[model samples]
Target: MTSTQVPATPARVTAGPALTSAGLVTVLLGAALPLIDFFIVNIALPAIGSDLRTSSATLELVVAAYGIAYAVLLVVGGRLGDAFGRRKLFLIGLTAFTFTSLLCGIAPTALTLVLARAAQGAAAALMLPQVLSIIQAATTGERRSKALGLYGATAGLSMVLGQFLGGALVAADLWGTGWRPIFLVNVPVGIVGLVVARRLIPESRSRNPIGIDRPGTVFLAIALVSLLLPLAEGPVLDWPLWTIALLVVFPFAAAGFVHVERRMERRGGVPLLPPSVMRMPSVRQGLLVGVPFFIGFSAFMFVFAVTLQDGLHLGPFGSGLVTAPLSLAFFAMCLVSSRLVTRFGQRVVAAGLSVQLLGLLVLIGTVLLEWPNLGVLDFAPGMLLCGLGQGLAMTTVFRIVLSKVSPEIAGVGSGMLTTSQQAAMALGVATLGTLFASAGAGPLGMKGAFALVIGIQAVLTVGVITVARRLPDPRL
Candidate 1:
């Protein structure tokens, strides 16, 4: 090990030299790509459905497939990055993501697009964890804090920007491509990222690399699939026998995963995720706050997109334009989030959540008042408030979650955080989406459905504040 590197573990110390400005930008670009893709399809789903002749059930798969695959394989992807070089994995993943995106752009049918999207998600899983692990390995102290804050900024901006970008691309209909350009646009960006990353990014890997945990990986996959499959497919399929069976299987599969992981730990081997990591007070409590926050955030994005286009009769570009103020607000706040954290400690997250609830209340009131007569301007105030709140909460929560992670397990820690966030996002689409659909189709109509979903999100935002109170103070 290099004498200059910090001592992180008995076997593997942090390997890379301090990150340069160019290297930091490369990794942040890599981080932005996957997050942007996660929501990029939200504003394009209608176009995809019309062009591909897909039913609503199949349309849901188009989104759910990417999120599920991404969530399921993330930890394993991290383990691979640790065993191999992180830079190598990052390159491979970016290449594969580029190819799969091309596949998605050229997909001949709805099923083909769905399958390609899942492949794209798998590529994202392999790529995304390395960004964080590399930062943890290559930077320290103030540099690490700045890098993390940029990552947070990148992440927040990407989610909001995805919808905007998708809308503009779909409306542009480049060469009459319509919805296809959203996926295709990544190809050029991926190519540029690859060139920049290879030149600027340093290669790093764990010194004491362990074998993959085959049993643990299998059990974890089963548990996630069993749980996510039912929630995503149940409403679409009318709660069929298979969905019920999978739901029943989920608990047992989860228990088996926990048992196997513990057994692996006792035998002096690294499991996919060591129980000790989850047992950490900061890690555990921080994830609790993240779940409800992401769930509400993602659901709001999905439902609002559909409502804006289908119910309110706005075009894709018009719908996306409505969110411009939110995106602007989020971007501006993310730039200042590090300063906010320095000043307020963990209270920033609480304050953010409180503001988000206030914004939701504003949105609910606006919907009730304007209803069928709503315009893009009507959503401006509430969306701006929500964005500011999200920026404050999202950036700081990421800091809090990884605050105590040592460099030795940076890959696994990054994987765990991403996995939790992705899982919650997929669940949000399933549960809240189903609620929206069911209630809309009922006598309550679209207006009532929108009201209920926003109300539920407000409740979830409150849950975030409750959990935030339990987090160890970041300033400490």
Candidate 2:
């Protein structure tokens, strides 16, 4: 083996032994910020475009640039965390994220805001992977399992809560900052997270930390940017030449990335992502499950936002109120999900998907029967069902996917898992978002478009449930 090709071993750190209870809370708090930020900004986009006097195209750039940067650098950040220390990387990332949020909040131009969002995304990339890695490195057995479940719950809760908070903040327009508070609010939260994390969170890193795999990194970056950029910007720009060219480059870059990683492994050297890691059935199956879950969840968030504001003529606050039931039930179910998984085992995932499918059917029915007249109260039943279904499915799947990841490469495992999630999310917004936009804009009308997309998602969920039922039970 080459100097850097040491076999995966135990997690080792110079700083401490077990992570404290307070430590887990601190890290989970750190984990929630980036995710919440991701969804929160959407509610404020209209105000952003108007205030900045930027066209629809450039405003979309504000979203795309951050997402692309965040998704691309995730694995790199995770690798660095394993090499350095999780706590150290988390602190640095949190600090940088806070600064960037300030930059975003105060930016004078659309271009600058876009740039700031990119920096913020890069900071998030640096911070997020370490949460899972920290739990992997410091906790064991049931503690680790509980932590992972909570992480999953945190993730599911964050998406809906971000949307809820974003609408409230923008509608309040606190001090007439007009959408700027959404970014600025991160400042205080980030500061608190930084302080608590440094004091309570334990430091950990891999015993055999791998060096940078430059070729793998470059190829992966090209592949994701080629795919994500085109998808993120294509609909906005109406499929320009450059976007098509990038799309054409995506598969080749992805192939090259795979080749580089495998070649490095064959040659007894380390690659950014070890082939062995992906070879695990738990990891593979979990990811397969995650892709569809993330796609559906993100697409729901995206389309619902558009539907509420544009189709129903609701203000941001009213939109949030409509989703309030879902958000609340999602939180409650997330807490209950852990217990259900323990009692029901592998069947819980299938059950969750079934519930989600029913919820979607209810949603379609509600839209068909009530829309144009559907108020916040009228939307409650379907929203509550969706919340319960998603909470159960999301938490259970998270446990399955990351259950077998070893501590030595926890960061890698976490990074790889999260990258897939972000890719699925980007794909969701691109594909389902496009479908909803086109349908809503056409004679389908907002109500019909809404039902159609939810019906499509319901079918997708049914397919996922079939796969979930067929899988072998997870060992964890």
Candidate 3:
């Protein structure tokens, strides 16, 4: 049905109990794939490198390629969903993602794996935005909040579980598959999701949908690719001249894309990003705040994993165990996020930042105090606090940013928010991760490198608090 035409309330006949339950599970399954893929490959990276004789540089590409491509195309993916049908795009994206996962599992060379990962990222861009849009359009008020809470919980849990699951799968070497199980495992999950989705999820789309803004899409893609590619690859290659050149062009390309979008909107044409949404203070501010937070978060996860595995002589499962407290705390906080947001308003976010900063400081202290004696148990308390802070800040931002958005613009709004998040995450890994890697090479070693990284995170936390002050007190 068109977005404007609300469907009749489901009767017992059309949406059977089994079908309804299947629909919810299908969307959750869809959401789980992209997140699961992200962290799952991380733990499996060392194994893949050993088995394939791939260098560290190429392995980085395997991870970064997927993130960069996914970040760049998310907005376009959302617009496609609005123009065609969310269900249609979702199905196509899911099928492509499933096939690509197979390709990644069977890849004979590092280059092939990287290329397949890029395609997988593109498919994820198309698939993920539709999940939120579908949920938003299909539910209202309290039900919406509940669905979003579930999503937040799933996201947090999946990231941690991805690591553990990857470790277990690799260790198990199911049928002598070794690291290949990381990708191969998705086959069954995707198949189940597809079958359930086809039988259950109803079709949805915008009425009076605008034609694709081809020029804007092209420029935006170029802008994002130019910006993300260099950062992700520059460190691996030790900052090549071409990488520097791309960095210089990114801003200009981004500006040109914005100008074209504005012109299109003025001429009574629908732009990929509607101008009105940009005008909303809540949306703009939330995005600005989200960038730094996600950047810090993504960088922290990447750096920590590497430090634990490489510097501390821990295995994949050990590294995953080290981070388990953070995930557990995050999940616990998210469960109460709705109530907290309702009671404390935006103050909860500010408090979260403050708490996170404290946690970082404590962790840093432990690093400095214990030095070479530090182990996963010693890190647990601080990591749990960090996770709590993250839960409060990130989940609150997700709700506050989208709370004011209209259902008509839901697809693009979700795209914009998610793209900002993904872009910031990639940037985090590139910038802060680079800093950690570089510092580790010096006399300070891993401890010194970690201290520097946490210092940066502390600074970002302060920025979050400052931004939180500027937001509406009671929140929406």
Candidate with top TM-score is 1
Candidates' lDDT values, in order? 0.80, 0.76, 0.75
Candidates ranked, most accurate by lDDT first: 1, 2, 3
Write the residue-wise lDDT of candidate 2 on 356-405 in tens digits: 88888988898898778878887888888888887787767766766787
lDDT of 1 by residue, 131-192 (tens): 87788778889988888767766856786778689889988899988899999989999999
Report residue 382 deviation for candidate 1 (angstroms). Answer: 0.9
Off by over 4 Å in 2: 1-25, 49-64, 109-111, 134-153, 156-161, 195-204, 404-410
Q: Which should have the higher lDDT, number 2 or number 3?
A: 2
lDDT score, candidate 2, position 469: 80
Is candidate 2 or 3 superior in TM-score? 3
TM-score of each: 0.91, 0.87, 0.89
- Clash pairs for candidate 2: none
Worst 10 residues of 1 by lDDT: 1-10
lDDT of 3 at 247: 94
In terms of TM-score, how similar is model 2 to the real structure?
A: 0.87
Candidate 1 collision pairs: none
Q: All candidates: CA RMSD in angstroms? A: 4.4, 4.9, 4.8
